[model samples]
Target: MLYSDSNSLVSFNPDTHTITVIRNNIRYDFEIDSTITQQELFLRGMYESRGYELSPIAKLDSILHINVIPFSSDTEFVSLKLDSLNNELDKFPKTHRKTTNMIPSKNYILGFVDGESLQVYYNFPLSIFMKKAWNNILTICIITLLFIFLMFCIVYLFKFMRNLSQYQEDTMNKIVHNWKTPLSSIKTMVELLQKKSISPTDEKGIEKTKFILEEVAHIQTGSQQIMRALIDAIHIQIDRNEFDLKKELITLIKEEKTAHSNQTISLDLQYLLPTTTIYASQFHLICAIRNLIDNAIKYGKDAPQITIICYQDKNNLMIEVKDDGPGIPKEKQKLIFNKYYQVVDKNSGQTRKGFGLGLNYVYNVIKLHNGRITINSTPGNGCTFTIKLKKWRTK
Candidate 1:
């Protein structure tokens, strides 16, 4: 005897070459042959197994017009009158290729009739058995890997396009700077020459010459900035530059302190840095320092106090410029370093006008050196700009 959770008992009858089932107080019997192929036996076993697990069992007896059961609920078992009786029900059934499916259908019909209460007795359809789960899991894994590959490709393409866009912007900026410088210089020189030809005793002529010299100096400063930007953009684009981390950031700190002797700020530079030299462009480093200094001078608040310090931290250089300024709002700190961004003095309420390019130049220079610069500021508190440059050595 074999029992399954589908509420059936199975037994074998060797004399009759049959399989028998007892389910819900009803008996079902199947007459199969010893001559049946092993494949057909296996298929029959599978259907019988499903019936025991999922539903009640029934034996199809084609010879009788009525379905046979031991006991069925009065609410469930009902007889449907046949409009025409076919003596065909008495014949032993013919087996077709599709007859394999009918075994489970026969079992389900028995289960439905035992449980359902209806006037009409309808045929029940068999459920399609789902294969094992591993195959489905494998298919899902394959599809997921394909989707990940596609996403990676899209990210790579976007990165490439962004780099291309940056290159074009750098080129345009350089060209515009170049064109503006020469014309500006020529205009200053022309103005100076004209001043010299004016009345000899006119003191205004001398002042005009001095003014022309200052104009030339300003243009020189601007030219240097543009050149630095162009070089940094090119080297960084090619990945040829790295941070030239210094162990003694204090060296520059002391020099800057001496340069701005009147400021009330104090210096504190302490973060461990490697003594090892980094491979970087010298021009870019100097420009980075210059931009920071320029920023400190322009924006330092009470008594224009600023402190410059540096030190080594692991494999990088940490240089900091802190100032007691009418601190930048938290929201504005990020925007301030962007190109063409400037914060006006709160007292003045007017947009402080310069090239609005200083901090932008600083950020680009630091980045080209494969470094990062960040701002720390709070309202009513001071601001500190920190530059971190990585350490690298040439093989």
Candidate 2:
């Protein structure tokens, strides 16, 4: 942190194998640099000059609390450690210009010389980066769990379908067999991750790793809640009650609009539907509707527009959700409502990631209310999902 004569602030302790740097009149200790080679420094200089991505390893030395790492050789330099990182600073100037532009401008390089007179380049925030990594890992874990569950469902459905016909039995068995490899691979990968123990080399690493794992546990609880909802749908256990359909939808749309401020969402829309009361589980219906809206958001293009339509069609109350998103294929439409089925990315031939239960839960939840849901879509046009429920019920 010494703005003037910062070079004089650095010193080395051979006996302790550490480096000491005085910043803002406070003493900071870092381990002595021993591992980096000249070739790696050369590569580092080239990589930072052309690439925008920040380095994974955080540099230890800093001026005025801004981090800077060695981009030049150790032939002539000062060793520094402020917050436990042992790093070297090159006495040369060219490396500073190459590395500073790669990160956000919170860093300024004044005089050059391996981040010397001009200092601080790509000050990577390890904790923030670590959090992003943990979230991605957690998402992958939840998806793997869903894939496993769906695979089992396919096997179970195959068994049930076997009783229907011999042709279906063979076809279903082939599907189950075709699906096994990827499922096994995912399962094996997750198992390996679960069994392997991670050991952090320093106190900072240990703290960050512990924080990420703890966060993973918190998010896993949320995933479990979603799975619980899917399981409840499978069991067909929902409390039925009479609620004003139009009012419910108006509220739903209002909520959705708030949740997706960037996207356009509307209800009844151009014209409001007349008041219609229907006997059904409001909780289940709301969940189902939300699922459809979520699907629309994910599959929709940037700033996608969604509209909820409600009206009376004879004795049935009809509700429709329309999205200005990529339309579903005709062949994939039927499979969409099947348990554990997700639309494949036509371009990549990869199954799209989705909520754990997906449309299958919505389909079943609607069916439980003696209602039906249908999709009307054409590729490149957009998608519309309509739900029809009896206006009145006898319980």
The lDDT values for all models are 0.55, 0.57
For model 1, what is the alpha-carbon lDDT of residue 254? 58
Q: Residues 1-395, candidate 1, lDDT per residue (tens digit)?
A: 32233555656666777877666667778889978753444345435744533211122221111222122111122122111231122111223123222322121222332343212232232221122355787899999999999999999977886576467555644543454445454654555476567666878876777677677657656765665466445433323344444433454455455434435545545544444355655434644665676566656654666666667677566778887766788778879877667787567675664666767767876876678999998966778888887844464
Best by lDDT: 2
Off by over 4 Å in 2: 1-221, 228-234, 262-272, 348-351, 391-395
Candidate 1: Cα lDDT at 80:
22
Stretches of model 1 off by over 4 angstroms after superposition: 1-209, 217-276, 301-303, 345-347, 368-370, 393-395
TM-score of each: 0.39, 0.41
